[model samples]
Target chain A: MGEKKFAIIGCQHNHIEIFIEQMYQLGYSCAGIFEEHDRTLAAVIAEKYEIPLVENKLSLLGETIEIVGCASMNHEKIDVIELCEQYGKSIMVDKPAVVNQDGLARLEVIIERNRIKVGMLLTERFHPAIYTLKQYINQGKLGELVHIGMRKPHKLNASSRPAWFFNKEQCGGILIDLLIHDYDLLRWFTGKEIKSSAGLVGKSVLPEHPTFYNTVNVQVELDDGLLTQLYADWHTPSKSWTWGDGRIFVTGTKGFAELRLSGDPLLGSSTPIMLYASEEEEWSKVDLIQPHATITADFLSFIKGEASLLTHEELIKASRAVLDADAAVLYKLIPSSKESEPHV
Target chain B: MGEKKFAIIGCQHNHIEIFIEQMYQLGYSCAGIFEEHDRTLAAVIAEKYEIPLVENKLSLLGETIEIVGCASMNHEKIDVIELCEQYGKSIMVDKPAVVNQDGLARLEVIIERNRIKVGMLLTERFHPAIYTLKQYINQGKLGELVHIGMRKPHKLNASSRPAWFFNKEQCGGILIDLLIHDYDLLRWFTGKEIKSSAGLVGKSVLPEHPTFYNTVNVQVELDDGLLTQLYADWHTPSKSWTWGDGRIFVTGTKGFAELRLSGDPLLGSSTPIMLYASEEEEWSKVDLIQPHATITADFLSFIKGEASLLTHEELIKASRAVLDADAAVLYKLIPSSKESEPHV
Candidate 1:
């Protein structure tokens, strides 16, 4: 419990580095790394970070690792999770892990059977603005929350993305891959489940890449009548330095707050949080208080058979709801004749 | 057509002055004014603008007036339009004139019989951004039109609103008086009719005002694959000078554009139009080319039996769609248990 070793199963998502860096800063030791097949990509990551590379999954699992963080290719995430669960190791996986219904059902079984930690690496959980927002709402600084508008845009380095990245069947479109973060964030911020939702999805930007849904938009109605509109796209033009220029606008009864995540890398910097009450003429930007240390500390406790920062139930439900949100997008769109033809 | 005289038939909405001022600047004569009941308000406006006040509706229509501008209360618009038509006068009226189905049906006949110049004074039509956008799209500078996201926030002078403003039956909630403007704007921008729409309306901000829908959010799907999201609220905090901090975001195949309608009067100014294309690394804020002169000139020409600036059919249809968009908000929301109880 004092200081546990954290190992990784695969290295596909860039978020893996965030987890590793955070854990390292929180005084955790690195054990070893394992990749299913792409040893070249694995070797590149291992050498870059100077971590030991293992021969096989068993070798990494058998090391001093008490917890395994898996950033496997989307299609292979479920299997990698199953392998880690069977070894009785607590696991942390990237977002949109089990996209399809079949994978979702398997995830439920693994979660219910084991007490080992299972967390989706929603790095936004470690973001300072989110914590600030929760504190504001909890203290009634902002009156009754009415609307949460989220924009989550990621820079899709098409060339760097693995073969599975373009497959809608595996990644569940732009809604799942990029937008799902907000779906979870809204729930955690509001403490209310989504009651109803409807939306639109388009692969508008990348006509040559017909299969990739580069843009997605959805409207979600919370159980308590809170209206939320979310737009996520892989529309970050190469000029931007950040991976995602995320944003959230929360409208409450007495006030409004807007969060510009990653400081609109397009602007070279985004204010982490900004708020304005009814009497205020200008928006006040709030300083971000990093939750990474606390988040990593919690994961370390979970690895030591203690309580997790976020409950397994909450994490599982968040993942499930995000996948369900994809259904809303699918049904809302009627196949346009243009879908068959390339966009002009 | 040679400097035709314009007359007013009500002085309820402040936009009536916007119409009068625009026409006057274009060399049209302000013949006279008439108000059904709010004569004190009408007389004050008449004296301030140095225009004479007529004895009645007939007196105003009997002048050198070739076209009548109506800014009657929401409930009285139909009567004013009917009265103007009987006198064989073409009319320009304030937005959301029709508050119900019967009003819409009656409006169709007024348009079908004669030109009657029944144009809804949608001034965003005159805003430099709309014209710049139209030029961009028409010149094929931006590729196929896709989505328009509109944020229209109107200042709620809660204490000053008339008795009818509180009644949805008369004013049609925030969706009717305010949100309807975008519904019309989107149609004009896309030149495509709406195929389907779904949304949520809430009395979220003003709890004391039970029946008033102070907040409304909607998603509209165009016949072709265009998507539009509109958020309207009477919740613009009292700190700003502009009555509405309105904005429109236009997304296209080759480029993207964002328009700030009134500029956040709080910031004291706004970028009227900004565009970014695939090759352009930074967003370019375009200089606004004022269309008010052109729009007013076109309306003046229409009075002489020439083509209308906006066709009657298109204008009426856009108005009808805006009313119907309200239906999407109606059905999407289930009455919350807390709706009956007073909110804090």
Candidate 2:
């Protein structure tokens, strides 16, 4: 098969660097880059990588690139969606595909009309620990799924990004930006749909941020008797670059497993995954899997028609669930709006 | 000094049994027992111990009891408060002293007029691990406190508790009943007043209970830079009376510590407490201190004027903070009533 050509649509996302490295590693030819406006790091990185920086999104359509990765800021998602539909290109957008329902519906309608393949960058689905977890559940190793608890707490840079990034209207606050990662993962792992969700979003710290909430706690009821609780925040003040403290704990009728990604920066540290069973007296270490690389590889394989998407409809459902949670928060924050009423 | 006498009021609270045992251990004589219209477990226990079970609140006034311990369910708090005030007795009510602001205000007024000591049974304040956590902060062992996280997840019996215990207006949901324990502890440890709080409450699993929410998540900002998040739930299927699957994690500028308590009876067969620290490479065994006994001992000494109440005003403030969070949830849950307007 001819080597697939790849291009990036935006430069405001944290995962752009990782995406670029993955593309090169996978032997995909770097076609070009597109940025809506000039930015220092985007320009410098594009120049350093010897890739063309297209001034307009339409210019990418003229290039022979087959896959466009949307790594734009949360507010700029609508523009990326428009470009993808215009070019009839298969695309993958970073998490929190769109902040509000209107933007999400617009994206959905465009994709439906274009009949193009669309994927969400829900890397948690590809996490080695999570993959292993899914394998165990499928094998009935943990017995009937009873309860799921997940936490994704990370520290965000105070200086980076535009001021609008902190606004609720722009990003849908922490529930979408931070907690949605787990919301999607919870739905993926439990194999259950969220019946109803209630959440709390408020400014616990960082009052300088424009949003009313910096932390969120959400309880989601699955179709089965399983209950999932998700706690997420961006208020931790650690200075580490790769500070993703993600933990997924599942309790079954027979046994339970707790998976955690180390927050410490010290590489070569072997303690990452842990599993415990009712038959055992201690938590045994499980072999770690590379989630980020797996996600990239899986997306490429899906593009090549080798494997079906690991999570597609689940992603949409998860996104909608997160939006519902955000609506709950907004209802609490701004009671004046009738649109914030609970759907259930 | 004359011997101090105490009366037991109600018995719906979980800690009542422990309180009675601790009172015996601390050598306090029961003056009487009071239950408004029904005979409760507290009255039965009181009668078994050869204490009088008074049927009328007015009769307690002539009994000369120095203190009244109100461990009634939410609906009975107002009558408990009035009876305590009428008898000119110092009072100690369970956490979430009242569900509504009007009831809370009335209790505050009665306490002010009677000029009597009032306390809330914030048993966490006397927890050895929590006390050690407080000492760590006071000694500046972990540098400036930055973030606090707590989890109080438990699996309760499906058929326990009265219907009113689940009602939003009656029990104030899980935020008040469960999360308030951590709220009081956070205020005590950080010595910071809660600036504001937002929370989510729902009955994700146990729909059988009609009155109260089964799950809750709350985030609060202290006056200091410290941020606190608490998760409380009552829907886990596993049932163990003497244990809980909960963890409290406190992070400081320099270090972090994690204390996990599991209700699995099997763990207690070998070790009582599991403690871990960032400085340590593995979880270690730690001695568990009985908080109920410690609190009862402290109260006995405090009543004798030998020691001060360990958690008094701080408990009240925590209860108020949690009540505010419950109000936040109710505002989100119910349709917009005239009371839904933000008073702050």
Candidate 3:
């Protein structure tokens, strides 16, 4: 990559730091950052990276930047992407790049009209445990995949969150905002398209935020009849050793494997990949080979017309899958008595 | 707890051993054991308990036996229970005491007509981790439970299992056979009744057993709007150190907890109760207080019309739950192309 540069179009979410850090790792300079509203972390990031904080986002997008990184509020991400596409710049943003079905439709039209690469920060794909699990799947350590179960429970810092964070119109529901990573993992590991899906969302806590669902579960049936179940919640206890207790349990024809993406409490900070194959007498922890190729590098390579490990299609497919799941929410549960009444 | 004596009416499943062993633990004698077909395990149990291997089941039932233990094939279990009920003998049997909805209806009628105490061995209730987790929940360590996720993956041991085990009509599907434990745990931990549930079953492996489903997933909505997800399969690798890699993750309003019922690979044989409470600084492994009272003791007490820790109601409820789930299986998959073809 020669003289690669990217500009931050929005910094509403802390996930923007992922893009910034990855860009710097790949020797790409940030031309400038533009956050319409003042965010403490954005300022911290700007000072750390020594990048100018621009007052106007369009001016930053107009820079001779190859990519526009976005971590805006869920609803505002579309405007950033559209502006980047108009400027002939590729884009990278956090998952659920589009909040709802309407935004997804608009995204489809933008991709149809533009040739620039667009990707989401599905950071789980870059985790060492994920890389190892993929290698095991590829090597047939686990025979034809049968099912995958994922649990992603994150701490919800209610007091620290912005007011708009609780609005479904702005933040999207938990399924799209949180479970998109699980959908992407399901597709990537099984190498199959989602044939059908059913979802349920509930607000067990945060009674004040009626529009925001704190608990969500989705079931996906793949084209080849492989099954996947994902449960995501913003219920990680404040005192959790890790931000989340994320896990992936894969069952195959001949064996099974478990990948603890966030460190397991029993195992401390180590991300352990536990495999129990039909040929092995006991479960063995596979040593991870830390991945050198970051998603940012791959996205930048794809933008610069070079070989890339990541593909543009899966990103869109994952987004579409999650949007469909969000749309497919079977039950809009009433917080107290779900048994007698489920309204819309 | 006088000279109580129990007879094994049919000893097809190895789980009969639990009843016999526990009866002996509580100082009850086994009057006799009657197996229509010679099973190695039945013979082993007869030898271990020093019980007579009777030629006729009726003769054994007539031998002043207060309790009749049945671990017969899934379909045959109902016949044994019915005979025991006819003889006015209290019963303790393996889970899914009755297989299908028809059998479940029969069970409800039997329970209404007979005063004999009947219980299924949901032995998970006796697990150390389960006991500890229940304590935490009851003590409000995890304040108002929000959601529960369970994974129960067991080794199929296909060749070792009986021919009838491969027949769905005889053995019940994976959900009924394996996930009854999960349903029972869900009710036990949440202290909430299941309001509505949806289930999906698929067979990704074991192609030859067309009648059986090897994979199952169920989403349950509780009365208080608490959600639960359960995934169970008959796909545990033969060489796995443990029979299953069972896990229960509980999310509550104030905190979260994880119970590794079958020891985690990383934690080895020690079952760990991990809690991340908002009041604590970090995740703490709770010390388990091993229960002196076993499921067998509770059943014996219930049969004797004495105070019992176990209830007669939850057993029927769990059976009803699993049967409803089995009946509620939405898609009858076509194995290869679930996308184009969902037969049911």
Q: Give candidate 3 misplaced runs (Cα > 4 Å).
A: A1-4, A270-276, A331-334, A338-344, B1-3, B270-277, B331-334, B338-344
**Interface RMSD of every predicted model, in angstroms:** 4.0, 10.1, 2.3
Report per-candidate DockQ: 0.35, 0.08, 0.61
For candidate 1, the lDDT comes to 0.70
lDDT, candidate 1, A1-344, per-residue tens: 55668898987766787778777787677777788766667777788778899877787776477778888876678888888887788888877677767888888898788756677776677678877777777777556776677777666778887766777775666777776577778788888887766776775555455567766778887887767788876655554445655667776666666676765322335556554545354444555556635665666666577766566666677677767877656422223644332121
Better of 2 and 3 by TM-score: 3
Local accuracy of candidate 3 as per-residue lDDT tens digits, B1-344: 45878788878788878888888887778888888875676777788778888888888776467788888888888888788888888888887698887788778888888667788999988888888888888989887777888888888778888877788888886878888888888888977888777767876556677677777887887777666788888888877777877888888888787777766656655455554456465676667867658889888777778887567687789998888877776545535643222221
Report how far off residue A9 is in candidate 3 (Å): 1.4
Quote the chain B TM-score of every prediction.
0.89, 0.83, 0.92
Question: lDDT for each of the candidates?
Answer: 0.70, 0.63, 0.78
Candidate 1 stretches greater than 4 Å from native: A1-4, A205-211, A240-242, A264-277, A292-294, A301-309, A331-344, B1-4, B205-210, B240-242, B264-268, B271-277, B292-294, B305-309, B331-335, B338-344
Over the full model, what C-alpha lDDT does candidate 3 score relative to the true structure?
0.78
- Residue B39 of model 1 has an lDDT of 74
Q: Which lDDT tens digits does candidate 3 get at residues A198-258?
A: 7578775665776777888777887876667889888888887767778889988866888
